[model samples]
Each structure stands twice: as structure tokens, then as C-alpha cells.
Target: MSGDHFHVHGPHDHAVEHAGHGGDDFASQIAVMTAILATVGALFSYQGGATQNDAMLHKNQAAILKTEAANQWAYYQSKGNKQNMAELGAVLTSDEHRNKFEDDVARYKAEKEEIKKKAEALEEKVKAEDELSEASMHVHHRWAQAMTAIQIAISLAAITLLTRKKWLKYGAWGTAAFGAALAALAIAHI
Candidate 1:
């Protein structure tokens, strides 16, 4: 209470004020721990989001490659159909025209082989992209788990601050450690 000024002290503010006076070291320690956990949680959340985005990008690439592979397969099928038609023509045509039809059949067969090879290559690329997407998603999940643990630790810290419970403080520390472990796992991509 000061001239022309008013102040209100909430429970947290009172606790912090006491902490400044060396009255409640536990409160101050919890406050510091909460701040650190919040910072680490934010970083974990960012990493989770980044990994999710990477997964989506890789998935999209896989889809595009799959479509290209499908198109190649379709082209190969069309060539096969053309080859069948040429073979039919060679069997029904006169000797003079038979050789020309046979040549056309051989050309179609070669072209189909090339198209098949291209389609198989595209399929392989799709598989690779899909695997990349899955790996990114796994990392993202690990980050999310780490973030969840950190959030729980933060909540526990707040509760401990309010109740001055030693058990809750220990729980918060344990949860924070678990979160750090998960974050390490994410970093290692394991």
C-alpha cells in the first residue's frame, strides 16, 4: 500500500516474496525448476512439430512417386497390349507384311521392357520415401512423449509450489528426468 498506488498479493506472489527473504527456499527452487522445465518443454514441442512437418513432406513425396509409378505401369500395360495386337497382325497378314508386323511386335516388347524398368525404379523410390516418412513420424512421436512428460513435470511443480509437498517435488524431478531421457532418445533417433 502506497500513495496513489494499490497492490495485490496472490498466493504465488506471497510465496515468492517470502522466498526473497529466505523464508521459503522450496518455493524459489520450485519456481526456478518450473521455468527451466517450461523452456525445455517449449523446445521439445518445437522439435515435435518440425518432425511432424518432415513426415508430411516425406509422405507427400512418396505419394507423388507412387502416382508416377502407377503411370509408368499403365504405360507398360498399354505397350503390352500394342505388342499383342502386333503379334496378332503378324499371324494374320501376308508373308510380305508379316515381317513388318513382327518388327513392330519386337519394338513394342523392347519399349515395354524399358517402361517396366522405369516403373520398378519409381516403385523403389516410393518405398524409400515411405520409409523416410515413417522414421520422421517415429521421431515426432518421441518428441511428443518427451513434451508430455515435461508438461506433467511442470504441473507437478506448480502443485508442489501451492501445497509445499516434498513428495510432489520429488515426482516433478523424476518426471523431468524422464522427459530428458525421452528427448535424448529422440535426438538419437532410437
Candidate 2:
């Protein structure tokens, strides 16, 4: 045979050549759609992770604040006990020593008031941190939902590519739109 003999093309080669010539536009469209969806899904996943981390940090802060508040309450109780002891000492002591006990009682009472206020303020901070943690978790859940929808859309796009079905393409687009909407809600903190 001459060196210029005809060569036979395999099925795969023919399909590849056909795609390069834009003969299978549906496949190219599906390829582009899935690529975009995958990128968006990655962003959604990252946002979900970040939100979760924020929620955990806020929860930890709330717990720390609660412990501090408890300590302040314990200190306040100790001050109250000291005040009671001073009052009793004043009642039982002689006139010359009674004035010192009275002075101690007044100081302890004032210290207890200050400690009580500190404990209450810490409790309020704990409540605020708890609220923030809850809100972050809510946003995280929204991001997760968006990611799930995007994953479904990407799967649908793959199926459409395999089956060459127009309806599946439309369904994939619809699901991707829904995912985008959920991501918007997450951004809005809803």
C-alpha cells in the first residue's frame, strides 16, 4: 500500500472532531453551564463554612461571658456574707469598737452593689453573644441550602449531557436559579 493510504476514524475520534466543529452545541452549552454552577457552588460552600466558624466563635464567647458572670455573682455573695458578719459584730461589740464594724458594713454593702452590677452586665453580654451565634447559624443553614440546590443542578446538567434532553437542561437551569436565590437570602441574613 502507498504511504497516502486512507485511515479509518474511531467513534470517539469522530465525536471529538464533531464537537470541535460545533456540531454538538448542546454538549458545549451543558459543559459551560456546569462549569459556572460548580464555581458558584464552591463559593456557597465557602460561605457556609465561614458562617459556621463565626457561629462557633460567638458561642464560645457567650460561654466565656457566662463563666465570668458566675464568678462575679460568687464574689457578690461573698461580699454580702461579709456585710452580714460586720452587722453582727457591730451589734455585739462595745461602743468604742462598734463604729469600726459599722464602717466595714457600709463598705461591704457598696462593694456588693458594684459586684452585682458587674455580674448583671456580664449576663447581658452573654445574652447578646448568644443572639449573635444563633443568627450566624441561621445564615450558615441558608448557605448550606443554597449549596445543596446547586449540587442538584450540577447533577442534572450531567444527566442532560448524557441523555441530550432539553427538558433536563431547563430543569437544571431552574434549580440553579433557586440556588442563587437562596444564596441571596443568606447574604441578606434572612
Candidate 3:
């Protein structure tokens, strides 16, 4: 290992060879990665908004169903003295309450028909909220799928950009952050 024109051997570092375009490619990669991450972030925000809207809708719907159920029970309880209890089936399943039950059923059916009409008119009624919330959850899930595609693409591109083994592993960690955020939001709804 003489100092006079000595030769030393190690890994043939390609760093210098690719170093010429490294900065350019790195910038390009960073720009693309930024765009993808921004898109994912925007989608996450959108999903959050959707979830809020859906939760409000569900709360409203639960209230309406609760009210309707209470009203229905009250109607049965309001069987007054003006109409003989025997003629108006006090007990729904009593065999002796046949004719009265039939009469009460007809009246109840009429009320139901009226309620159906009202419901149809008020499309925004809270009655159908649970169904709407269930639907929102599905949409959120699909949105997450779309977001996943972006995450995957970003990760692959990041891997390609990262030559260092340490950075390569770290890239995966960064990519997973988006998925973890989306999962957290989704589980909140559940």
C-alpha cells in the first residue's frame, strides 16, 4: 500500500456516474410524489366531510324513527272510553278481539298509508338515515380503494428514486401513513 500511485479496490460506486442526473430525477420524483400525496390528502379531506355529513344524517334519522315508534305505541295506548274496548281490539292477538282487531287494523292501515305519503313527500326525512349511513360507509370504502392505488404508485416511484437501502425502507413507512389515516377515518364510522 505504497503512497506512490497506490491502488485501492472497493465497491465500484455508480453514485458518480448517476450523480449527473440524480438531482434532476430527484426533483422530478419529488414533484410527482408531492402531487400524489396532495391528491391523497385532498381525498382524505373529502372523505372526512362525507363522514360528517353522514353522521348528521344518521342522527336525524334515528331521531325520526324514535319519534315514529313512540307515536305508533301511543296510538295503541290512546284507545279511549268513547269506543268500547271490546269493539276496538285492545289486545292485538286475542282471539276474541277478531272484529275489533279487523277494524283497528283498517284504521291503522289508513294511518300508515298517510304516513307513507308524508314520507314520500319529505324525501329528506330522517327515517331513512341508517340506510343512508350504510351507503356512505360503502362510498368511503371505495374512496379508500382509489386512494390505495395512488399510494401504491407513489410507493413504487419512491422506491425507484431511492437508491439507499435505508431510504428505501423509510419510503414504505411514508406511504403507509396515508393508508393508516384512511383506515382511522373509516373505523370511526364503523
Clashing residue pairs, candidate 1? none
lDDT at 188, model 2:
100
Q: What is the model-wide C-alpha lDDT for candidate 2? A: 0.97
Cα lDDT, all candidates:
0.95, 0.97, 0.60
- By TM-score rank, best first, the candidates go 2, 1, 3
C-alpha lDDT (0 to 100) for residue 119 of candidate 1: 94
Q: Show where candidate 3 strays beyond 4 Å.
A: 1-22, 80-127, 164-190
Model 3: per-residue Cα lDDT over 26-113, one tens digit each: 5575656657666765776577567657766786776776677666545534543223443455654577658666686666666656
Measured on C-alpha atoms, candidate 1 has an lDDT of 0.95
Write candidate 1's Cα lDDT for 1-190 as tens digits: 6688988889998887776565657887999999999999999999999999999999999999999999999999999999999999999999999999999999999999999999999999999999999999999999999999999999999999999999999999999999999999999999
Which candidate should be chosen as best, given lDDT against the real structure? 2
63 Cα displacement, candidate 1 (Å) = 0.2
Candidate 2 ranges with C-alpha deviation above 4 Å:
1-9, 16-19
Q: In model 3, what are the clashing residue pairs, if there are any?
A: 61-126
Best model per TM-score: 2
Tell how far residue 91 is off in model 2, in angstroms. Answer: 2.0
Clash pairs for candidate 2: none
